[model samples]
Target: MTDGIESLLPPAVAIILALITRRVLVPLSIGILVGAATLASQESSGPLSVLTGTASRFIQTIDQSVRDWDHLHVLAFTLLLGAMVGVLESSGSMARMISGWTRRVSTRRGGQSLIGFTGLLIFFDDYANTLLVGGTMRTTADRYGISRAKLAYLVDSTAAPVAGLTLVSTWVATELSYLQEGLADAGIEATNMTFSVFLQSLPYRFYPLLALWFVFVIATSGRDFGPMWAEENAAAQKPRSHHKQSPAGSWADIFAAVMPVGICLIVISGVLVTTGLQEPAESEMSRWQYFGHVIGSGNSYLALVAGGGAGLIAAGTLAIALSGVSWELVIMGSAKGMLQMLPAMAVLWLAWALSSLTGEDQLNTGGYLASILNERLPVEWLPTCVFLLAAFIAFATGTSWGTMAILTPLAVALSINLQQSLLASETLLAASDMGLSGGSPSGTAASLAMSPICLATFSSVLAGAIFGDHCSPLSDTTVLSSRACDCNHVLHVRTQMPYALVVGVTCILFGTLPASWGVSPWISLLISAAVLWVIVRMLGKHPQSAST
Candidate 1:
């Protein structure tokens, strides 16, 4: 049950089940049960005891996950965020806003920009963003000769990056909580360092930032290549989306949409800083230090929940007052929105439970992996290795959050162990130039010095997960984006894959590999961006849509 085939069984089984059944919940449940059974069998008193013990452990794992405050917070945040989206949708604010925006998009460039712009604005939730932006802009994109694949690409590309990068989105609380759990498992016991760690990783997250710009470059540059170009050419002579007949929305509807989002951002930021300062400070600190402490100690979960509630109220209130939506109707819409989020929430819960099974002492997936990787994985290659591992897992499973849940702890543990092993040997001296002149700094200094590598590896997990999610045909977001755009899902995947690969390969070569070698992330990002630009410009051609 170590890091060999036995340790691989649960994830392997889960992935196989998923591939065969094409269902998320049941496969994940079976995987967790298998993992629990394995753990119980290892400690069984006798043959018959194994079954009862495994069942007991499986139930215990579920109960433990339910009782976990962090898990509860994530579930609450998802449902609340859903309700907020629901309110906006029901009140006609979102539809009205989209209609208003599409009126000015007379060209393919203009239409693509509108889609990217809308996707960026709806950073609160990727699911909501994908569906809303795709549905709204599909008609305009078609009229402007923008292919369904192109529209789907624009929608799918912007959704995850925007949500992942934004601090107050539904992705944040869950992402940070996993990081916290991972760090704890890895032996980094700093109190409430989730936000601080996230802040550190933000700039280092090269793929998401670069990917977003890639979309912008593709959109504004009027360039197409690969299957996308063929699709663009085909669609130029034909089109489909019905939004052309949709009427322009009133100003009240647009304002209702805008105000709620603005308020959500303001409230979440305000509450994060405020909540972090709730406990009395033991000593005075500089202004920057105080701010750092505040963010570091803040309850990100509550901040998101409060923001979601306030946004929901603001959207509903404005809809009732300005959009002429009845109060009862708004409430019903809210219910609908919350209900729409159930599928995603179910996936999230199963993922969290799976994380508990893998990361906890029950399965010790992280410990087992760390044990195998201690000396075998060079410290410098850790980032790239993790990036590939995460990408493979997410691609196979078609769930980024699920990938994060399963890999974050393992990545954290591996990186920390690699750091410790490197530092405890002469390898650290050769790499960091530690010697008698500076002397091998021991204790806290070594740990502090090792942080950059650790942070880079951590960022790789997220970056790689997004890459897999971006390209995976099995990904729910990909399906929803296609459906929202009224595009054939397989065609959407086909068109997007080439572009995604360009970005993914660029990230692997210039971003993850170099960062692991101690290159600054900013420089790596610049290199990756340049590489992406060359690929797009040299290979891409202007879209041949007759409508253009």
Candidate 2:
């Protein structure tokens, strides 16, 4: 039975089952059972032997794909972030700071700007941005009658999207490393492409930056959409209530919460600088040396742990000093806060593991896709096709990082192939110009067919992936945003989609036309933004219409 079902089961079936069940152990078990039963049916081997062999293969595959040190570092950083957030929240320091600011601003328009600016200031880390901004600003937004959905949209829109675009951000280093490796594999010079070149290309990352700006513009201008409009309207229809009394917390309380985050940022920056300086003068360092020097030195993880630790200590001290809270109360609050984040951490780990499994060479879904597209797609359509493909994958994966990790190499490879084909065409075109000395007219036409079809496909892929992640409900930042604003999950999704779709369509058009027409991607993006502003103005007129 297992053999028959395994033989019949498609990869799509496997993906759907895995996603729907949301049970990592069950999905992995099913995958292994299917593989084993199929092998046993094909051969005369015993069931146990087949099962053992299949299990061994799976383990070996995982071992080959998993970067243990990278995983550990991610885990450490996540825990530290969660703990730090808990400490800050428990101290009520963030609340005090936010209250102080709210008292000074005291207007709805000012509140929106403050929230957006706060998101920008925490650009170094998306998780920090989401939690800090969300937790700190919820009361302020409520006071000003802003819908929780809108607040979540603002926070979510700014977090990962902004961080991904920033040159010195955590995402950049990871993305750059991946890009550099892919370039190296293609025998391209790494030094030829600096981080600055990537930054220049980032304006072309249409989805994220556009989404961020659009959200801010809409918020500040009092435009609303979908559930956001409904929520705000409903709030307006109800009798206005007095603002909640500000909680009692002194300036010292605010400092306690902020000091930890400040220390963490300072330490991480210093470590990054030192790491940059310590890098060998050579163009490329060995993978082992790179890993050993970075992880073995323990600077990055240490900075995070130390930051969280310091924050916890400071919070406790402040609680005792100012509020007369007992040590037990502080310790209990810290522990509870850490525990509260355990489920989210588990989800993070599962997502990471799934990404690892899918990205394996033997099981690479993106590579399979590249092969299919290579055969079926016209050379001219490659850029647009890759953009849409990456968008779909990122939406399904709920991670821009995972989407890029799988797609970037494949995009690079496709670009290189297209370039080679174009080079050959140019040679034939030159031959044809020389009175068909080397080839017939028909042959020249055939050679020139693919020349006009340039490969600006990678830019499209980047843009699309960011676009999808920007709106995806399953995305980490999206979840954080909703949590931050205390908004209903479905409401946040519904409200943000209109804005996201508009930006996405703009990006697609820019990618397809101007990008294919030999214009620089940066220039194309500027034009797209101009187009977006027109659309926003038109759609923003009836804020009430968005409620429907």
Task: Give the winner by TM-score.
Answer: 1
lDDT (Cα atoms) of all candidates against the true structure: 0.78, 0.58
What's the distance in Å from true for residue 121, model 1? 0.9
Residue runs of model 1 more than 4 Å from their true location after superposition: 1-22, 189-191, 237-248, 278-289, 360-363, 426-450, 544-548
**TM-score for each predicted model, relative to the true structure:** 0.89, 0.67
lDDT for 31 (candidate 1): 84
**For model 2, how does the per-residue alpha-carbon lDDT over 223-311 read when each residue is reduced to its tens digit?**
55555667777654444346765665466766675666676666665664465456554458787655444432334434444444555
List the pairs of residues colliding in candidate 2.
226-546
